[model samples]
Target chain A: MKTIKGIKISSGVVSGPIFNFERGKLTVPKHFIREADFDSELERFNTAIRKSKDELTQVRDLVHNHLDEDHAKIIEAQLLAVQDEEMITAVRELMVREKKNVTWAYFEVMDDYEKLLLKTFSQFFKERTADLKDIKKRVIYHLSHEKDIIQPEIIKPSIIVAEKMSPSDLMHIDHKLTLGIITRYGGVDSHAGILARAFRVPYISNINRIQEIVSYSEIILDADNETILLDITDDIKASYESRIQDFRRHRDNIISDKVANSTKDGVPYHIYLNAGFVDEVKAMDPALIQGIGLFRTEFLCIERNSIPDENVQFQAYKAVLEKMNDLPVVFRVYDFGRDKLLAMLDLEILQEDHVFDEWGGIGFLLDNPEILKAQLRAILRASAYGNTRIMLPLVMFVEEVVRTKEILETIKSELKREGLAFAENIELGAMIETSSVLEELDELAKYVDFFSIGTNDLALYLLGSGRMTDLTKNYYHPKMFRAIDKIIKAGNKAGIPVDVCGEMASDPYALIGLTAIGIRFISVSSSALAAISDEVSKIDVQQCGKLVNSILNADSAFTIYSHLKKFYHEQLE
Target chain B: MVRKEIKILNKYGLHTRPATALVTLVSKFKSDVFLEYNGVKVNAKSILGLLVLAVEPGANLIVEANGVDEQEAVDNLDRLAQQKFNLE
Candidate 1:
């Protein structure tokens, strides 16, 4: 069997038929229309237009009912294109004058319009070409009496093989039959990728020409290893199938125990799960962990055409809180900016000197106070149902914390005046991500109830490396560890609890270091919770503390990493 | 015919959604509407037509409408542009 490597977004193993689901380019077959069939041909074109409009209306209504108004607007936009008198008249003239088939005429009109739009609009507006193309394909499919190939009905469980899947396409995919998804182009942060993770579907992207390579083959997708094995032998397939079964069995056992949160040396610490979508929260068993540490609220805004109202926000937060059964849930305010632009909000992004620089966390929130206030009001309203806390991301200054508190006070008073029932003392915290925040940790900690150190950004910011782009493994240097140590120490001095809610906290090696540094609470992805808990139960906290202290003294990142590796195998492992 | 010149003011300029809003508004009136930018004119009631104008923030466009509801259409579109297409 040949193996293809791809960038894995979600982890799982499965074997299924490769459903070659490509959006095949529409080809317009030319035919000379006879004089007698002219009137009938024109009538046929009108019928096709009517059918196309009906299909779009149904799709729009379905999207509106199933998803949200914003998603429905995508189809609505296409409907408007269908109703464009200019486009209709152009197609009608082309068909009647050139004696061309309806499909050919429609395609020619759309092609000419696309060229004109390309010439008229700037490069920034060039992306709209895809939307225009989508409209063309939909109408042409109706004219040709062909089914829309994008939304195929899968009769059995199968792996979806495609060039790319849009967010709208991902929303419409039948989860039962879609065993896994492999695409030729996409990033882990793409909407389809995010949706795949949220749905717990095995997905990988950026495999070059995956659609052409494997044609109707029974493929084994080992997403955990980022490999897709084509045409496996029966013996190999049996082994792989058993391996998947073993993994599920192991996972079930780990999740079933409901183990207490304490190290072997009896050092009790809190393990919290990071969740974004409500579906991910529902998939999780609350009995397994303390509570949700980082509830990424941005997912609620991602697919919508308008800002989610306070009541909608309230329902989402309330559902999570009620599901947790009073477990303290920390709702992070919408951390917009960078690649996470809310097209609906149209909030002005603060210009950075470099295009790559991000405008995330509290900075984006503070710039749009109306959004911030709405989210605060929603979180506060939800807090009435269960235990909840508010956390601000990317806080680098003391003034940010002070200003946020001032706004929180204003919201609280407004709620009180309205006679709304909300938790009066919803604990507010700041995320210590930037080096600037680390430097002023003590001063900043005094204004907040707790500190959650987002080590992903902290490490990247400390080393001046892009978190995703920098291929060098040395980004997580001993210098970064020193920063973490200083922040934890400062939190202690200020008498505020410090927890880590980043990728570093999830790593077994980093968890040892964090525990040694006296970090009592750690948050990790929900999928990593059980595995990390197992590691935590094996460690002797006192010994880890000593080992970390020595590792921190190392001259370089390589030296520190090596020491930790040796320590893990010899003592912890 | 009623005509008015207005400047786009939203941060994102007259992008797809804002253009859709403008077209949807103009389509409600019986007046035939047209928008002119950089000496290129397009039917204002067509979303694709408006999108081709590629109006950036601070760009000026002359909107003209003719028919029974010409005045209403021009006044409404002018107000919408002033409000930044209600994008905020």
Candidate 2:
């Protein structure tokens, strides 16, 4: 087998057929059709278009049945482009205007708009490919864009080598057979990089036109050493043995050491797990997590379909509770406004839409009050096994808290009247995802037993930025601290326990910053639990307290963020 | 054709989804539909035509559809105005 070398982006070893998709262009065939063949060529092109359109639909169906209308337009566009009135009519106009045959006229009209069509189709394919989660999707996407001779070989073990990819492409690649990803273009901050980290696959991006260096179906890879050995032979293998030995050393170095969370003064903080899905709960290390602090119910409502049936919802909730056993597992009810989840639900049911109509309609999460009632009723039913807390997301005002509490009270009284044993005094809380909640903390805290700061959303709202789109925005920035400072002061004043559950909580460097801001409680991912606890345990709370005071007095979020980084590095060094 | 002008209020500019929704709504009527914004007028039923208008949040636009449901067309088009193009 021939071999080629490149940088390893992720670490894994596999050998499979190489599916190299070159970003290419298609245009009108060079030679014009004769008058005799015009009818036949047009028919052929129409057939090709029909076939491609059918393939797109089929491919989409394999991944998902119902697509959002916007996504549906992509397929619609492809269909429309095939017989576009403008393109067809333009060609007809050219035929009469220039005295050219139908095929030649069609070619000339298409040729002028060829670049525009390609650009449109390319973007459309990019989006559709990102949505693809399986091979059927890849094939469909490829077929949609490339109407030429289309074929898909059954390659069980496959390796994808692409110039660059979107997040959806990386998500769809069959992780089981896909050993590694080799990209000629991308960066450490690319979605591909984020995905590689998430999938635990070794991938190397930004290899400088590395595609030309390695041919399709070439044997390559040095997974552990972060190299893609090209043209490998026994001699090359023998020579790389020393490097292979280092892999063992590196693996040993990676072996994580366990540690507990205790302050310098020996005060301990709860490092709970902030899990969303049942699978994530199963993945958590029991020894590391105190319990599930905030289970985002919104994730359960992510896909475009019917609201989860009671059994489905119960199963997911039960799975997390079962794994936690006696550990406290707080189930935060779906609290996001209708924009993300229930965009199609009736507007009247959405609470936020009454105030804002930017979202097409209130999503089911916020719009449907009955959902909260139904979900709380489900949780109350499951409360027998584990310590449970029912929390809400984006708790903005006191009235919402009162409204939810009233519903819960009714559920409790009904359970009592029915003579069923349930956890009567289960804790209630809200995610401080919006800054507005901070203003209403005095009144809101009375209803909530504790608070969890979802810095992701809070920062987005505070910065007036898009939460999903703007990833570069940091919660560790000074403005976030100001918000956190407000939360800490408000929660502390109200005597309500408060914690943070954002990606920022996963950062060890932020542990001291959090504690300094009087955020003694942190809910992190299972993978981050041990490391954060270890870091938090070592921090001098008094020193953190001093930092918090300094940060609070600082002029801006950036200044406070920079100061914290300097302090963290100093401690580490 | 009777014409009425309105504004685009959705945060995200008129893209495929909103365009499709708008076009589909107008197609329900038996009227010739047209839209004008920034001095450009195009067929309301055409996606490319609608997108080319690049109607963004806070942009004023005019709608003209003349047929059997021309008044209903104006009413539905008014809903788009009231809906503010549905971007949050």
lDDT of 1 by residue, A1-573 (tens): 788898877677888887777552455667878677778777777887786676566556644643456556656777788878887888778877988877788888888777767885477567667667767755665566542332456668889888877554564457768888998866654556656755667887778968555674688888889998886899889889887786556434435656458888898888888887786787667776688899988777643323467888999999999999988899999876554543222112111213445567898778768778999999998999999999999897899889988998998899899999899888999998887777787778779999998876776677765533322344347876788788888888888888998767766666777777688899877556777888888888778778765767878877766767777798866
Query: Candidate 2 lDDT, tens digit per residue, A1-573?
Result: 444455544554543346664432122223443456545645554554455455445423321323344434544443344444455567556655555644446545544543333444234422322211121222233323334422222246555677765444453345555556777765443435545544445566555655554464544456545456555566766776665455434322321444355676777777777665576677655654578887766556432122455556776777778788778898877644424333312111121222333221112344455566678777887786678888777776777777778788898898789886678789888788776667788788887898888876677678765432433336556777788888888898999998897767876666667788787788865445555766776677766677866776777656767877787777643
Model 1, stretches more than 4 Å misplaced?
A20-127, A132-155, A162-174, A185-199, A213-216, A248-254, A303-306, A342-356, A470-475, B1-30, B34-44, B49-65, B68-88
Residue pairs with clashing backbones, model 1: none
Per-candidate Cα lDDT values, in order, are: 0.75, 0.59
TM-score of each: 0.71, 0.56
Question: What is candidate 2's local distance difference test score?
Answer: 0.59
lDDT of 2 by residue, B1-88 (tens): 7788876666555654566567767767889888887787878876545654556657777889788889889888878767854534
Question: Which ten residues in a row are the worst by lDDT in model 1 chain A?
Answer: A344-353
In candidate 2, residue A177 scores what lDDT? Answer: 55
Scored by TM-score, the top model is: 1
lDDT (C-alpha) at residue B83 in model 2? 85
For each candidate in turn, the interface RMSD (Å) is 1.6, 5.0
Q: Can you give the DockQ of every candidate in the order shown?
A: 0.38, 0.10
